[model samples]
Target chain A: MAQQEFDTTAFRNALGSFTTGVTIITATAPDGTPVGLTANSFNSVSLDPPMVLWSLAKTSLSVEAFNEAKHWNVHVLSQEQQDLSNTFASRGENKFAGIDLEEGLSDAPLIPDCSARFQCRNMVTHDGGDHLIYIGEVLNFDQQDLPPLVFQQGQYAMTARKPWEGVELSSEPKAPECSYNEDLLGYLLGRSHFQMLFRMRKVFDEQAHEDSHFFALSVLNIQANLSLEEINDYIEYTGHSLTDTDIEFLISQELIEKLDDETYQLTANGRETSLLHIAQAKAIEEELIRDLGQGDVMALKLLLKRLISKTDPGLPDLWKAKETAK
Target chain B: MAQQEFDTTAFRNALGSFTTGVTIITATAPDGTPVGLTANSFNSVSLDPPMVLWSLAKTSLSVEAFNEAKHWNVHVLSQEQQDLSNTFASRGENKFAGIDLEEGLSDAPLIPDCSARFQCRNMVTHDGGDHLIYIGEVLNFDQQDLPPLVFQQGQYAMTARKPWEGVELSSEPKAPECSYNEDLLGYLLGRSHFQMLFRMRKVFDEQAHEDSHFFALSVLNIQANLSLEEINDYIEYTGHSLTDTDIEFLISQELIEKLDDETYQLTANGRETSLLHIAQAKAIEEELIRDLGQGDVMALKLLLKRLISKTDPGLPDLWKAKETAK
Candidate 1:
């Protein structure tokens, strides 16, 4: 790791270990052309003087315009701006052609819907190896509630914030020798799934429906007019199969009707019940988004989807379009 | 937000929206006293020169020590070093009493087991409002595989890195008007849980055991001796209650034996089976840790625990200490 014999790729990889927020620094050229590029080098330098700093590669095409510009704006991008980040990161022409800009303290482009923004006047420029560091005094700044996008290890990321104190499931820690503990991924996933279902159980209990009956109704709601055997293929992974008695019970409750001796479809009452389940599930999710921040919930869903894809056992696709003839 | 009359709290909050990796900057005083403090303002400034910068409040107690020091070390804290971060953050005595220092290129007190470490020579100190910015030229640096600790919006956080492309569960985009999609948190959780269990089912199938029998055995393994009602109390949330028929089936398989025809305990074969399940679960988890990075899996577990705690329905604790007399 000698400074004189530094390996460029290794150094970049080591530097990438330090995570940073994504930002797009924008400046206006002498001809009134808006130039912007994605950078994660932005950092707050001072508070009382309201200063910030960011470095740019000397070889960048926008370097000359940025050097001549008197003012520039830093937009801390939100998670929703990944596409915009990619566009500005490349040598795309007319980057701001379709963008609607907001008025700011300077002539620099002010992009809307950012987590934070800093309008600054260039105060000084310092030599930093192959890059030039631009220090500025912030003239005005604003913030929004959107979650900032993060970059780490050369990939985009999102943060699942740990509370200041910490999140504890039990009042006391589990015994060390216990075979199963709260830390087990299996236990955590099962508990989360069942607890969510527990809330929906109250709704189903009103109609004297068991868990298997609910599963059957949910399947019918998606791909209608399916035989009992076909519906079971989609739910066999759940370890609960509907018996003939369970189908008969659902028919007795007016939740399903026989299209033929083998095929079945949801009745009007059954469709209403299934829709109620979906609505309740959405309501519970809304509460979660409120409890946990939207970004954390999004990360959770992303990881869960990945897990599902990795562990899938060749189950039939639940959302695939059914045959029109059927 | 005028710079002259800026509200300090709001400004600080706005700056915090720019996420950063946590670092502990350390240097030795004239009398050889080790001083360090947590700072999130660390950022890389150059690659060719291998330079980095961080700012410290001018009013800090270690200001004089740092000002006089010719060299300092920057430690990028890992997720496992949260306690060390807190200790250095406070004005505590003997912050380095128990820490094991690693030899570095400079005399700066280098801490061991950090995600990354940079031994730097103090290049320049710039006036930054009420703070002093230290720009250091790195002489040598090293990095580990540990996940870096993150700070965002005034709270500690962990990151779940998204792949370069993205995570898409389905092959095609879902219909806009569909009632249920892969985006549903409930559906994701259930699918994730069942899919994980589906893999474990292959192991269980070798023994001709059903999912409900496995659940019952899991409960019996923990509590040793339990009546059928007691076991059902723990397994009911799973929507699988143990019945007399289930107990008879287990007896027929020689997996369990009845004590006074009421209390039930696992036979030697049953204990072996339960232990095998635990090992299989752990192996599956290891594969997940490989597929999803360890940090992302950790974040998923944290979010799941929070979700379970929020939605808990007062189920009896399975790991509670049982009465020895009983």
Candidate 2:
């Protein structure tokens, strides 16, 4: 197959679809001086040992201070702290000159009314692209319930606690198109290990001779369109107990019929029986519902139903019906 | 060296210091059914190919729909779209019961008034732990100038748009029990790419066999009090560079004194030079500021400085004038 080239601009813009928080790491120089920089590359690496990590460019001046300092601090900004994000990000001579701060554990500077704070020791450095990873072992920390500042799509933003109402009041834009088949399949497999059954049938079909008597009746019991020989091979693959006697009994009852030597098929009556297989899928669905609770399940189901309707305009009653019964 | 352990919770909480935006992924099933799911694990992979990627749990029902889907839609939440996030995250049969949506190029569901939207074709899938990575080729997308929803530390947060009118702050913590010498040494070496100078000194020292003049000078340059031959190799391992001509120049300038062929040391003037090196670092702190304009840089810097001060109660002013200037 010919390879298709990938467009990174479109891709990055696509991924920018998700938003994240912003932070600034700060440390003191040897002569008791402070240095800092803004970073969104910060992440939690461990919790038990009270560790966190952030990445800085190898050429950053603050990096030297951080590496040399006995301790450093991380500040979580509140939605009202946009000015703070700007200060540390600028090339100013005295960022803290007019900033509000208080002394905390080990005399660390703490901004009043910020969301959270973490004082830590440098852990180790890791190699990142033109950057050095700094892991900090949190020695002390604190937090408030204030809202946090967000960053997405190259812009600073804030989180909204409320849900979206029916109408588009703000006028942002439409989302990109995406197919939901894969998500549905994933849910199916998770809910009912059906993929195992599908694979089993394939394996059984491979083992059977060109024309041979197999568990044709069971295959008919599941997916009735298959030939009797195909059914037998599938039964073998799925490890279901089937014998020639059962095949004869099924034939006698008119649930199956012989098409030719080593070839057989499911009768009309057998096709009707397979509808129960779909019902079997409900057991898994019910289990998921029970685990998630009625409210959560209802939410997920509704979202999915709406999404499905977007694809096929005809599923007008998808939400109205509990099950899509055949 | 002994192996060290890290704490995951502490790390996560520390990194939660940052905030980000939220978005929902929408797609259709193989048989033309629609489905959608809430996701924050989306990020830009590349810009040139116009490709974007996100990870879906292998167990998500929407995963299956997404896999066989011809197109997918992404909806970036707005500041007022908290309800939208809740609706998308909840499990229900009629998520869009009272919602308004428009048809895009592929008839993909467009959540009206979102911060942004992107329609893309399924590009590729890669195996991830308990998830599959789906890459998309963005066909079309849109955006609006509105704040996006953000989630951090498992809570909703908004962007901090301005600096708090407050007092200046400083580092509070007293020095740790551990001596600051190692930190000082690490800081000095991190300043410049002087490793080549160290390499030249290494070659000369090996050849001279007599008290290597180059090694003696490097030790004196940084730690003037150290006797040349008595300097520890462990300290030398961290040093980056020295040159024979540089060493000779320092001695000629009375910056160092050679006690004998086997002994040498730094004079008073050399110690003052080391202090000046760290001071020059402040002007070029934001080396990692990529593809950002001056306005963005200033805003980010200001915000970062404020946040850092808020987080570290013991942080001192990183820039302090020399009190012992000659």
Best model number under TM-score? 1
- Candidate 1 lDDT over B1-326, as tens digits, reads 34467777888888888899999999999999988999988888888878988989888999999999999999999999999999999999899988989888878999999888888999888877778889889888889989899999998899988887787776667746448777989999999999988889999988888778998998887777799888888888887788889899999988899998579999999888887887788789889999888888988998998788778899887777666775
lDDT tens readout by residue for model 2, A257-303:
76655555667764443333223333333544454333223323322
Q: CAPRI band of model 2? A: incorrect
RMSD of each: 2.2, 35.7
Q: Model 2: how far is A97 from its true place, Å?
A: 12
Fraction of real interface contacts that model 2 preserves: 0.17
Query: Which residue runs does candidate 2 get wrong by more than 4 Å?
Result: A1-20, A25-37, A41-75, A78-84, A87-147, A150-326, B1-17, B43-53, B67-71, B79-81, B94-101, B105-108, B121-137, B145-326
C-alpha positional error of residue A177 in candidate 2 after TM-score superposition, expressed in Å: 35
RMSD of 1: 2.2
- Taken in order, the candidates have interface RMSDs of 1.4, 30.1
